[model samples]
Target: MTLPTSTLDLYWLPEAVEFSTAVTALRAAAAKGADGNADAGAAAGTARMLANQRLDFLQTRTLDRAVQGLPDAAWGAELTLAVLGTGTLEHLLPAIRVAGLRRGLRVRCWQAPYGQWRQQILDPAADLHRQRPDVILLAVDPAELLPDLPLSATAEEADTALAARAEEMVGLWRTARERTGAVILQQLMPLAEPPAFGHFERLVPAAPGALAARLDEALVRAAARERVLLLDLGRSLAEIGRRSVGDARLWHHAKQAISPAAAPWYGEQVGRVLASLRGLSRKVLVLDLDNTLWGGVIGDDGLGGIVLGQGSAAGEAFVAFQRHLRQLSRRGVILAVSSKNSPAVAEAVFREHPDMVLTRSDIAAFEANWEDKPAALRRIARDLELGIDSLVFFDDNPVERDLMRRSLPAVAVPEVPDAPELYGQTLADAGYFEPVAFTADDAGRTRQYQANAERRQGQAAATDMDSFLRDLDMVLAVEPVTPVTLARVTQLINKTNQFNLTTRRYTEPEVRDLRDSPDVLTFAARLKDRFGDNGIIAVVIGRRVEDGRTLDLDSWLMSCRVLGRGVEQALLSVVAASAARRGVERLVGHYRPTARNGMVRDFYPGLGFTALPASAEDQGWSLDLRTAVLPQPRHFTLALSV
Candidate 1:
């Protein structure tokens, strides 16, 4: 019942934990915890009721987090939590509704047809387009549900069967993607360690290694193809050592004794990941180099002594950890490093380490020095020039983490482990780092960060700004939304935060819906300087208003990557000319301010829009379409068709 640190609590992650424990408690309360000698008999009768009450409480808490986290403007949004197959859905649906009603979201659970029913819940194929949800949570395992026969198999063998089952699952997901634009995400099989076979295990296996891996591969591959998200509930369970449903003793201790005052440990983790995924943008991963990233301190151990490689246990763990980070970096996570070691030592390890997954060039920023981490983080923020809050900091020392948490609190700090093996799962479990989608720019992040460092160092040595700009040979591709570039455009609208003018987050469904509206216009801007191609980084959303004579800017947001280089003007010009050609009377612009959006408070005024004093709780400003002058840059050119 304690208030969570953030409204973005992950209730879904703990569904398995609470449910398993509730079942155990129901039996226990029914047997011993009830009435006298005759009362003891009565106690057995009340046990199930008591357990159900506990189950109801846990479910209520889950709903509370979701309801509390729903953004005010998103109230009345038709939210649907779809439990694809049977298991926890029966219990979860009721709790989700209670939570949804409290939050003002019109939420409903779509129960899929049982054997006798004629698909009472509309087929995803039929209802997806019309029954759009702000977010979709799928509890069923497609890989398990796909036509397969492995009832007699052990967990490991079943996992093999599941992997073999992936091709079909992938196809079905693709079909689902074609049908609906709603965000699709699958929950990990719950942790029921030393899991026994029955209803749940009969459908799927419990071997964490083979089964989980195959399922993960299947889910991640499907997510990549269908734009679905894979949230790791299994990893969350393992983190707390709640290995299996039989770990009732551990669950009881966790719930009653160990950390009674803390937020439900399970729910908190779930909520954190969910909130982050809901509002993901520019997934820049800034790693720490030293005892944190590797095993031993780089400065003390020396480059050769630093723990990494396949030889030693610690070295192997570090190597494995580095590989994982590199994988994330490759998946469009911008990689950077902050360390208190000498740059020479850091570079030597990056370049010379045989087992190293990342090199000196992979990092966006290599801030190594005597300066405290917050200061280094500031430099990394300035070098990348992104809001520090967007950066995810990983450090071995709790002191450094506390520094950032206390000083610049917005940055996400996943709890760090002393040992190396735990590093892989802890990082994976921290949802702050999860990316919903990847673009070409994401894949090239390491190289871009390396390029950024070189560019900045080059700029520092240059005599003047104009000389630097001219020497960079930056290429800008200002173009209208195309079929190929549509995904990145939607990603920008959904993710880009710091430089976003209005901070209006959009779902892919809404972005697709824009296609049918004649009044709405959206554009994706691609930038490639002498540094590197920054993929698609800017999105501008506006509508033709005033009887189709004027274009009014509804949302104009850009990733921090392309901010400093005067791309905004090119973006505005793109919109301006499109409006000019459309025979619109004028182009109107607006700027509304939020705490994080203050960086662009003067954005509209800078673009020649008059700032009106007309302010509401969510402030508003406007510029007349007629009075604004369209500024075109000789350096930037546009290629687009309205």
Candidate 2:
């Protein structure tokens, strides 16, 4: 098969073109050589370049039919985003749409009128409140926020001004949440110019730069209280170079604060944030050992001879990459190895090498055999109980990377740079593991998965299922929803796929609404056994129906980690007892089928509920609470909160 003559072909296309024409060209390029034998890695790289060009072109050229021409029904997810900013954001729509399309989301953006952010946010009957967007982007400019701060102001005056600005912004965020209940994505103020005091700005607490820093800190604190997510526009600007991203001419002419040329970059940053919030963030990073972890193959080079540490330039580069991987691991990204080498040799490097930054303890699973990389990756995913699509693979060999791309197109196979020093930067730029919020549960995820592996091993050794569970010494806790557990419950509702009956996704605010509803009963499950603590693994929401005579199970999902541990049975037992206590005669359960939830098709039937005929994609089941016996697992000790 023939490859694209040059990756730069798209770059040479005319800068000005109709949006439809550019989109057609992009689709044609992506679809070229569908049955051909071109290298998958090269094709992916070229496609990305072409997509960037198309987005850039679209941002500058307006299309009357932009929204109508968007691909329909094929996106993995959909989001209604309301953009409320002080500056003109008409040019931002095309770029945001393109970014969302790249990330497999159909983004419908509604822009508030220019400079009407305050009116829109504060008014209860505004368009924003009426639209009820899923996410809100608050992109206010610093000058607009603190216009009174001048060069002559004293440090004390600057401090007071900054404090007032912080309070105003925080109040706005709280008001927006109360009105619309959408996840707030607030852009931190960027420093468009240097402090007027020059060197004295560093010395004076009230200088513009110093005040800006103080305001940023206050914003961070404010965000923590209300769970607001701050998009670090300052960092993005620094990365892209402030001079390249700023346009004074556009700011004066059209009230456009950011440069049109940088629209695509800003859109990309926003897309990553949106993806994380929608539960599309990647969960695993699968790495190859030879040439990826070190300078040479472990089988050929002894642990002492391999390059990984500070002695040489190449070695230091590998060390930096390993350090970055470790940092990612600390933030709950599971690390696994899928190397083609002797198992013994690989384990020795992780175990015996003194210079190794990543040890065997850091890895959740290690698959070191001379198997095809794709199979190894699949095994790793299964071992961790994660979807294969959630895994990101990295390898230095072009052939292996191409093979992975062709075989497992769902897996993200990033192009590793030839130079080792660029590895960490390249991975960081990809933003595959962006997170909306880091909870206590996130920090302990690696350990929890490791415990799962241990539990699996114990199960294998047990003679029967009953014996296996009994030996686990399991304890299941059922508790009413509280403020502390609300975030995790919402996360489970959004992230859990398998073993979910309805496959419903909810944002934090929606979860809060359900929890507070007088007619709804919401609770979470926590399980611990001889292995370890599996924190907040399951969630159940039941709605009172038929004048409180029946408890309808609105949603039920359990994490895959606790699937085989009888947790579901225990949860159902609790629900039944609760319903019976509430004078409910029967319990109703609904099952909605999705592509990812086939594992639970027989869930209600297996639990002795009578199925009623429903639509082709859904099933309804019911059980009489007065007569139906609650299934009790002899192995587990259960407790319920008052």
Candidate 3:
């Protein structure tokens, strides 16, 4: 299949093009254009398949036919999305399942008993109580939860009604979390009632439209306070088109809150959010130099010849794209450059160009060399110490993009628009950096990576690893994982891969459970060197085994940026000391091999743990905390919380 570059408005963005024409060739091949496998890019294909198609039956059959099935083992993570709603959910399941593949998630959806959203949660015998679900989506209409007020009702009466609904939601959320330990998501009610007062609709506090808007606002605030994710179907469908928002006739006929026509888009939004929680979201944005970042070739055009900045339209477009990248960096998306151009020539543009919204400091890794774009991309990943999969490549050249896709199948390569102005929007629409919630650690990610670059340079200059570590004067501060530190600690547990031993992920509530359990031990590690502070780069969780004195290591994961710098050893020192204080005599650890966590296979052995024979590939290791002398911190001082 030919790739898009010369045409974008007519291509990828499902809403912008004719649905049937967009997938004519895609269907002939695999979902992702690879072996007609349903596990591939069916998530992306399903959206375009259902968009602009009105027949719900055709959408269901086509989506089901296209998304044959994705095996649970096909993805790195799997989750059961138990959808509890007051409306129809069967037509939406196929699209939701396929869309999850876009983020390497195998999503299995379960529809709650119809119109029993309350009984389902309040009763322990409900099927939802059979086992723990990873995620629970409560998609209910506002009218189902709140009372309708008369037009003559006071604003206080509306407020009273909204407050009671919010209270009930919190009760449901708490009950769900306590009962099932699932990440709860409350979908905001769609404002489907036609304008009762036109422009004056918003002023009427008791109007259906106004109450719907108020409920959304109230749900956002309550969800934020209660640690629940909000699925804004109103916003998602409104973008598709007003008609896709909801059809009153459909609601009356089949109780469909959202049009079945927009199921693909709905699933896409959901998949992105769920994938983000699993740490499948892209982190690094790798940009090409010549036509992608600027309008012309830097080698021939020089600094003066390149089309950039305010005077020309393309220049402003490039500036706007750069602005978008800079904004992403501020929100914790690491930025880097991967170009096949002279190092000096490319560096000169970023250094001297006045129109550049992205400065040198904004970039965590800068690769401007004579190597092929693929090689440059690999170097960028290595320099950042991130897996190649964490990157999203944006290049204006279709050949280069196609080459990267074939070479590194894991890396995300968005089809750049022919027009420069569409670059930022296209990238944004691609949804590479969907964050679950912005934490303090996310806010400092770019700066931390930039500091990591400085540390790499220092390591190269030193005589040996020891002196480099000693000269840096590193300090590791260890704290008990509390709600204050829960987000970052939970993030490190889910996000860190390479240096991890037994890659076990935990949701936020699970982390809190670890903190509350009397027999469990948890640690959040923060490292600071001479250069800058690496915020909460490591996490360790341990649970007391059946043998009271043995503490089984449930999880241990550290950021790759802090690897090989004695940070691992230092964190282990604190962990051992903490384990000793809890009357833990022996520590048992396990190494579960994953595609990305192979580097940590010998993590226990390196720390002097005796290998125990295993029946499977997962090897068990044990250390005598009573007799085995833990490594003394010669490279850094340690601080412990009281």
Q: Which portions of model 2 miss their true places by more than 4 Å?
A: 1-240, 445-642
Best by lDDT: 2
Report the alpha-carbon TM-score of model 1 versus the true structure: 0.33
Model 2: per-residue lDDT, tens digit, 245-295? 665688889888777877887887788778778988788999988899899
> Model 1 over residues 266-339: C-alpha lDDT tens digits?
56556654554676443566678776667778777675456665335676677667766764654556788888
For candidate 1, give the lDDT of residue 89: 53
Residue 267 displacement (Å), model 2: 2.0
The parts of candidate 3 lying over 4 Å away from their true place are 1-242, 445-642
Error of 3 at 427 (Å): 1.6
lDDT ranking of the models: 2, 3, 1
Candidate 1 lDDT (Cα, 0 to 1): 0.58
What are the models' TM-scores?
0.33, 0.35, 0.35
TM-score of candidate 3 versus the correct structure, residues matched by position: 0.35
